[model samples]
Target: MNPNGPLLHFVIAAGLLDSFNPCAIAVLLIFIALMFTLSKNRSAILSMGFVYIMFIFLTYLAIGLGLLKIITIFSIPHLIVKIGAWIVIIVGLWGLKDTLFPGKRNILAIPIGSRQLIASWATKATIPAAAVTGILVGLTEFPCSGAVYIATLTLLSSSTTFLKGLIYLIVYNFMFVLPLIVLLLIAANRMILEKMINLDEMNSDRIRVISALIMIGIGIVILKWFV
Candidate 1:
């Protein structure tokens, strides 16, 4: 079997699912709203949004590279891949619980203190502040949405060279941020932005359910084939 084929499919599917993560989308909406209040110029808002998203891409890519390096150095990619697959399954179940129960303690959420800090940075509406906020979001949002990422990295580490894995990581992270890029593009129009926000809110639970299922499915596949 050609491993790259299934891996590529998984990368694209998992990346798209991760892109709609409620945590990242919620933070993005908040940031866009704050940006609207801070600046009336559409160009300024877009510029800041671009910077914010660029930082998010960079941060996530860096983390993937770093983890891949560590896994390579340790020469335990197969073990780690198996462990990551189980973790992905667990995270999917946890997500489903959070969706169904709707109030149980969620250890996967961004910390309140970190959220407050991110809010403060969002309020600044400066490029540097946007960069910092993006970095913070990238770090803090992982627990909420990083199971797929870990699964991808583990699989990559086990089956591909670092260079090939790096290429996949770049593509995966790009797909991961594609939704945010779309949101940023439409953010200049208040009515459209509000509609998108409304849709996101209305379908948030459905999205979670779908994402959970995908994660569980991917984990099972990894355990069955890649492990």
Candidate 2:
């Protein structure tokens, strides 16, 4: 195996898990439905979707950089990573609980109170509306699905330089928004919205399980790295 294989695995896996966040996808689905209803032209909807994805990408990249800086400022970056790894483990366990006993409420998604707000904003569905909704979703969804991102940033803070870190962030964010881009394409083609929503609802639990597994795997790798 290549020397950087583990790092590559962690980054890509994290990005993929984050990308499949069901809560974010739910918001995106709603956004798409609203856009379809609000705008007559498919091109306008695509434009709005692109703008929304861009905001999410930029916001997440900025957040990652900010966290990376904080991690670097710490005197004991390795120790901090270890602690963060443990936190990631806990996060994974929580995800597992949600997956296994899905009815139980968890801290891994947007609050019920905020769902109404997100829906309200997304209902506007114009370019500016999409932009604002994108910012809101990106910021709000962080606490719900940010473990993989946090773990990755912590690891990178101690292990890589700034330019490399930026590149990794770019890759991660690209992967993060990829699913949304695809969904936008489907919507632009005027596919059945109800089917997509139904599909997401059916798989949301599985998404949680997969995310938990990947997070646990990353946590284990981090511990082994320290060993």
Best by TM-score: 1
Model 2: worst 10 consecutive residues (lDDT sum):
1-10
Q: Could you tally the backbone clashes for each prediction?
A: 0, 0
Error of 2 at 82 (Å): 1.3
Model 2: number of clashes? Answer: 0
Q: Model 1 compared with the native: what TM-score?
A: 0.91
Model 2 reaches what TM-score against the true structure? Answer: 0.89
Off by over 4 Å in 1: 1-4
Candidate 1 local lDDT, residue 141:
90
